[model samples]
Target chain A: MNAIIRSTARCLRAGAAAVYLPVRAGARVWSASPPRRLLCAAADLQKDLGAMVKKDKVVVFMKGTPAQPMCGFSNAVVQILRMHGVDQYAAYNVLDDGELREGVKVFSNWPTIPQVYFSGEFVGGCDILLQMHQNGDLVEELKKLGIHSALLNAEKESK
Target chain B: MAETADHIRDKLIEELAAVHVDVEDTSPNRCAASFKVLVVSSQFEGKPLLQRHRMVNTCLAEELKEIHALEQKTLTPEQWEKQKSQ
Candidate 1:
């Protein structure tokens, strides 16, 4: 039995009865009669969202607008990309959709934001982006797309 | 695939007499899968960010395990009002 007890009318579907498992707090979540089916379904949703991120060559899901990012991290990505001169990328703001905002997690298998997906692959977030930019790897990656990064010159003053 | 963000939201609604709360699932791109949360409570006036986040984390610890990211935007009703004013 699952130790921690809480109750709500859970929907396996909309207003449908699903397995009622005993989730004991200390015990394994589902040792007996697993909620595997429901979990798989949920996993599927997360998977789908993950797929969408990779669906584009470069997708930038951020806050506010790309022109004026609301968060520091978002701002950093915008700044770095501008420096890179890689002008074409998609930006989706989670702020607009409460469901997409909260439910996007299951899709990406990731947990943080300013999530950038590139070449239909999981590109790391802000820190990774900065690291890549510093190493010239980010520029090289963009050049693979036939876009030469102007960031090389931008780094001149800093260096 | 874990618990729905709504499940977390429901718990908050049950626990707090919340007029406004928002939960965002941010698992698509970072490590330690997380949910970006914005909660407006009359309960959180003088509390700092750490304390406010801790409250939500504690309330949803089980879900937190499944959930790797918790981006919280916690504000008091007064604070929220101030944002609106601005």
Candidate 2:
């Protein structure tokens, strides 16, 4: 498991490096900012994130994968999605990439992990998701995305 | 010194002008690394959920560095009253 995690981390880093190289090279030439390198790196990460969130209808950046969340908060997020029958979403394990873990916080301007995105829009963390779930806002939000939540079906079946 | 629930409560009350703040230390050993908080303030009025959370995050930026998990429920005073009545 450790080996697999390590390899995955390596691949992610390599992928980030591939994205970073071109930006760094381009910035080296004519970038006027005094902190040119830092700015370029931040911009590159943001660009990557901008694409990543939109790549799926739902995206979750959490402490662990949906199948096995490492933290209780992350577990709660996984559970909530599962309860809504939202199975086919992008889940990024922040534990694998320190840079991604930190970068996402800055990207979303959120301070915690287990950040949820719907249709590339920033949803709140576990607390907000729980609130939405309780208040029935999640069902409406899911419907907007054309997803018929399982809970809604279940409610109908029960009645 | 490690942060206590009262410390967080005081900070939120002060920084956000919170009318009601409840901070519970949920760490297994009372280590102060994890917390669950409910904050009610007029500052959260007219703000979306994410923005309200961001306000609390920014208010506790330094404390969050030492904390592990933070669960927040932010509401405007009116919302808080509604919830309480319910």
Candidate 3:
């Protein structure tokens, strides 16, 4: 049943892509002369992205791992989540998997990397996270996930 | 090839009824691969940040195929007015 639902979702996504992004639909972004690795790593990326998103309450498909992020944008997101008292989230390094990297963009229907998901729901990337943090929405969202932000709690207690 | 910043700017103004739109190419060497966009529109008044980004993303779905990266700051007309003053 789960597999059936997943395939149906994939079909719907493909349909939407054709209708929405007709120019780039069904075409993988490859070099002028595509490398062997790029062509060969065409794994089932939709399944991989889905598994990763469902793997944890919070998941970040970023350029590098949390300890050492490759990009400034990814690093910024990691730091913000840390400041919010989050330390346990799944992080996938897209740099390691070409297929995963391209698949992720398609899966999220988002152009950038360092995408964040909360409880299987797609959240926005760096800018959105920053805005949520600034407006105190991140704290509330974390609370709903049963993850408490120590910094937020401290601020509350001081008031 | 992706559309130019001017094209994106004009499209956003037309589609989103944007009051202010700034699309800057942020890639190295001034390439059009990446962009930073700030859009102010009355349409975003009641939407959350995620939805606002989604709206912008959807608006530029075709352009996004060639534009490798995009960082967006979406704001409402009232918020944009406040930002301008400050």
Encode model 2's per-residue lDDT on B1-86: one tens digit a residue: 68889989999999999999999999999899999999999999899888999999999999998998898999899999998999
True contacts kept of 3: 0.86
For candidate 3, write residues B10-85 as lDDT tens digits: 9999999999999999999788988999999999989988889989999999898888788999999899888889
Q: Measured against the native two-chain assembly using Cα atoms, what DockQ does each of the candidate structures obtain, in the order listed? A: 0.08, 0.69, 0.59
> Candidate 3, DockQ to 2 decimals?
0.59
**Candidate 2 lDDT over residue span A24-140, tens digit each:** 111123232211122234466677787777766788888877767889999998899889988777777888767678889999988889899999999989999999999999999
* lDDT, candidate 3, A92-143, per-residue tens: 7888755467788889888788898999899889998888888889888899
lDDT of 1 by residue, A92-137 (tens): 6777644345556445544456677777666656656776787678
Sorting all predicted structures by DockQ, with the top scorer first, yields 2, 3, 1
Each candidate's TM vs. the true structure?
Answer: 0.45, 0.82, 0.77
Q: Model 1, range B1-86, lDDT digits (tens) per residue?
A: 57676877888767755568887777765333567767888777686544565566667767766764566666788878888899
Candidate 2 vs candidate 3: the TM-score winner is 2
The TM-score of predicted model 1 comes to: 0.45
User: Each prediction's Cα RMSD?
Assistant: 16.7, 9.7, 11.3
TM-score of 2: 0.82
Judged by DockQ relative to the true structure, which candidate is superior, 2 or 3?
Answer: 2
Candidate that beats the other on TM-score, 1 or 2, i.e. the better one:
2
